[model samples]
Target: MYAVFKRELFSLLNSLMAYITIGVFLLALGLLLWFFPDTSILDYGYAELTGFFSLAPFLFMFLIPAITMRSFAEERREGTYILLATRPLTDWQIILAKYLACLVLVLFSLIPTLIYYYSISELGLPKGNIDTGAVIGSYIGLLLLGSAFTAVGVFASSVTKNQVIAFAISVFICFIVYTGFDAMSQIFALQYLESLLIGLSVNEHYQSISRGVLDTRDLVYFISFVALFLGLTRFVIGGRKW
Candidate 1:
């Protein structure tokens, strides 16, 4: 598992596409947080990272899929998965290695944004007046959200041999998981089921955590979401005879 993890992570690091994707993700966020009129923090006159936190998840819906689209898809398409099957690794180990590597790339994209936090903190009216607690909680929520998306992406990749198809599937699933539930909850016909629908939505839990409250229920939901998708990936891979 460790060896597989290293190989996958190193491969991503060596790939120019991975770096370009991360670069574009960061660059977009920077532009939104600083230059965009409607969403810019400076224009809003607030000492918060609301712009970043709000825009990030939408960007992630696309960014994560791009990162994971080639994971198992490339291997399967190139006939390298047959070689991988000859290894001593178990299905779960292989799936997890790819998942962890994608997640590390997500982490790399996020870590650089901390500079925004510091810049915002210093730019506050009274200096360092930003809501530290809420920012921390939001970061926590963001990381968990990224993890769940990575699992979904990996599952999408495992189901197809084409990276483009994998990316599309992952993005569609991510979109539905992120906001479709909330939209469903708002349906007049589903009013009775609103609470249940909202409970299943990723945005609901994410918004709750964004307020700086650490709720175990929200944390559990994110963890379970990741596990469920990863289990699905394992099931798919295991079903393949090769």
Candidate 2:
């Protein structure tokens, strides 16, 4: 598992994908937080990063898929799946290693954004009147949300040998899981069903956490969501060998 993790990390860093993913994230961050003029948070209001956090999950819908699309898909495409299957590692080990590698990459891209937080702190009216709790909460939510998306991407990649198809499927799945429940909430006839749908939506939990409210249920929801997809990924890969 450790070897597989290292290899995936090394391969990702050596390729253009790593640079492109980081570059695009930084570009989007810049555009939304700094260069967008009227809508720029820094230009308009307090040191609140509401805009940044608001845009992040949506941006991650694309960026996470880009990073994870080739994890298993490319291996199968290059006929390396047989080699990996023959190794001593179980499917769970392989999936977990790849998932960890992808999570590390996502966190790597996210760490640099702390500079924005620092800059906002320094520029604030009272020298850091910013809501530190909310900022921390938002970052935590972002990490969990990214992890869930990465799991979905890994599962999608495991189901197909074509990277493009993997990317497309991952993006589609991410879109549905992230926002589909919210949409369903609008159409549900029963009030309890509507509430349940809203509760199942990723955006709802994200919003709650981003507001500095760390609900245990929301945290569990994210963890379970990630585990569900990762388990499915392992089952899919194992089934293929059978």
Candidate 3:
């Protein structure tokens, strides 16, 4: 499992595409938050990273899928999945290795953005007036959200051999899981069902956590969400081998 993990991570880092992907992710977010006069942080007149936290999840819907679309998809497309299946690793181990590799890359893309937090903190009128607690919570929520998206992306990639198809499926699934339930709750008439649907939505849990309250329920939801998709990836791979 460790070897597979290292191999996957190393393969990604060794590729020019990996760097390009990270660059694109950062550039897109940076331009939207810093350059566009209309929506720029300076124009917002608030010394907070609310814009970043708000925009990141939406952008990640595209960025993360693009990164993981090639994970198992490329392997399966090139017939390398057969070679992988013949290895000593279990399907779960293989799935985990690829999932973690993608998660690591997601974190790498996020680490550079911490500078934004620093910039905001210093830019505050009273200096360091930003809500550190909420910032910390938002970062934690973002990481959890990114991990869940990565798992979903891995599962999507595992189900198809075409990277483009994998990317499209991942984006659709991630977007639905993140906000579809909330939309459905608004449409449903039953109070109980509406509450249930909202509770199931990723955006709800993410927003709750982003408010600086580290609730165990939100943590459990994210952990379970990640596990569910990873388990699905294992199931897909196992079924393919059979």
Candidate 4:
């Protein structure tokens, strides 16, 4: 597992892909947080990252898929997947190694955002007046959200040998998981199922946590969601296919 994990991570970091992706993610957020007129913290005159937290999910829906699009597709294309499998690794180990490696890139992108929190907190009139709980909770929510997206991306990649298709499917699935259900619940005909639909949405739980309140239900939902996708990825690779 460790060997696979290290190789996966090294392949990403050793190339320009990881750096470019992280740079793009951070640059987009930085502009929104400080330069964009509508979303700028300076324009709002506030010490809050509500803008960052709000805009991040949309970006992640794309970022994570791009990262995981090659997880299996490249290996299969290069005929190295069989080679890797012959290395005495369980299917779970392989899945998890790739998942963790993909997730680490997301973490790398997020860590640099802490400077935003610190800068915002200090920008307050009296200094350090930001809502620390909300920031902490939102960061936690983002982490879980990233993990869930990574799992989805991994599963999407496993089902196809085409990287572009994997990215499209992953992005679509992530979208549906994040907001499609909640959007669907808005139909006048589906009002009866609104509660259930909202309950299943990442946006709903994510919003709850973004308010600085930790709920065990939200935590469980993310964990279960991630596990479900990871299990699907394992199942896919475990099948007769490559």
| lDDT by residue (tens digit), candidate 3, 134-215 | 9999999999999999999999999999999999999999999998998888774655589789899999999999999999
Q: Where is model 2 more than 4 Å wrong at Cα?
A: 188-192
TM-score of each: 0.98, 0.96, 0.96, 0.97
Model 3 gets an lDDT of 0.92
Ranking by lDDT: 1, 3, 4, 2
**For model 4, how big is the CA root-mean-square deviation?**
1.1
Tell me the lDDT of model 3 at 39: 70
| Worst-scoring 10-residue span by lDDT in model 4 | 233-242
lDDT winner between 2 and 4, please give it: 4
Q: Score candidate 3 by TM-score against the native.
A: 0.96
Q: lDDT value for candidate 2?
A: 0.90
Candidate 3 Cα errors over 4 Å, as ranges: 188-192
Candidate 1 error regions (>4 Å)? none
Which model is ahead, 1 or 2, in terms of lDDT? 1
Per-residue lDDT tens digits for candidate 4, residues 81-175, read 99988888889999999999999988988999999988988889889988888899999999999999999999999998899999999999999
